[model samples]
Target: MDFMIAAAIAALLNIGLLGTIIVIYVQNTRLVQSYFTYGLITVASAFMVQNIVIVIFWFNLYTAGPAIKTIVDAAAPYLFVINLAQTVGLAVMVWINT
Candidate 1:
């Protein structure tokens, strides 16, 4: 599939996950009141932000000059790995706190 197509799909999935988490936060304030819950929210937000960045990167790659696209391409993988680590850390926080 094309990069833009893939990025659009990722953005939709990220939005879905963010929406679900927000709903969870709203529905179970008791469970979502803890520091771990905050951490989860933060991580999820960061993950969504990172995906947004990736989508921007794809947009730039398609529309921008080569230099800017190169920079975005170089940075996107690092952001993805950082987001992945944050996700794992959030999972650990949930496991430890529960």
Candidate 2:
């Protein structure tokens, strides 16, 4: 698979993980009314937004000129790894929160 494709998949997964985390954190905040939980929800939400932006950027890059595409292609693998790592970390957070 193309590196961009892989990166996109990882980003999608990260988004899902962040969504799950946000849901859980929201529930926790409602129950405990703790500022810390609210902060967690905010951070997870920010991460989710970042992932959404990354996915949109990747989709736009698909139609970019060859020069830009080439540069993005070079960076895609690193991006994928970062996304994948975030996914794992978020998954762990979800697991812990539950």
Candidate 3:
């Protein structure tokens, strides 16, 4: 349960970070009209969608009752780490862009 909460938080953080990247990329794309900027926007958009899905999945698991929770517990730490890593990576990207 704790791990799930952590994972969810990390996922949410990732979504926020990705949103920042996407906005920056969109602004740059508008100013520069470069293919690389367009690609960055596309990739960031895709990552945002992925983080959204991860959050949704966490919510579903939270409401799934005890049976599924045991399974989720086993996987929660991995999910948390994965999401945290993504958040860190995205944060760095945002930092570099800014």
lDDT of each: 0.59, 0.88, 0.90
Model 2 spans with C-alpha error above 4 angstroms: none
Ten contiguous residues minimizing lDDT sum, candidate 3: 54-63
Question: Which consecutive 10 residues in model 2 have the weakest lDDT in total?
Answer: 58-67
- Please write out the lDDT profile of model 3 over residues 1-98, one tens digit for every residue: 58888999998898889899999998898799988999999999999999899889878987899999889899999999998889889999999999
Q: What pairs collide in candidate 1?
A: none
Off-target runs (Cα >4 Å) in candidate 3 are: none
Sequence-dependent TM-score of model 2? 0.93
lDDT of 1 by residue, 1-98 (tens): 24445445646565555656645654565755777767766776776677677667667675778768667666556555554555455455445544
Model 1 CA deviation exceeding 4 Å by range: 30-32, 65-98
Error of model 3, residue 69, in angstroms: 0.6
My TM-score estimates for the predictions, one after another, are: 0.54, 0.93, 0.94
Q: Which candidate wins on lDDT?
A: 3
Of candidates 3 and 1, the better by lDDT: 3
Q: Of the candidates shown, which would achieve the greatest TM-score relative to the real structure? A: 3
Clashes of each: 0, 0, 0
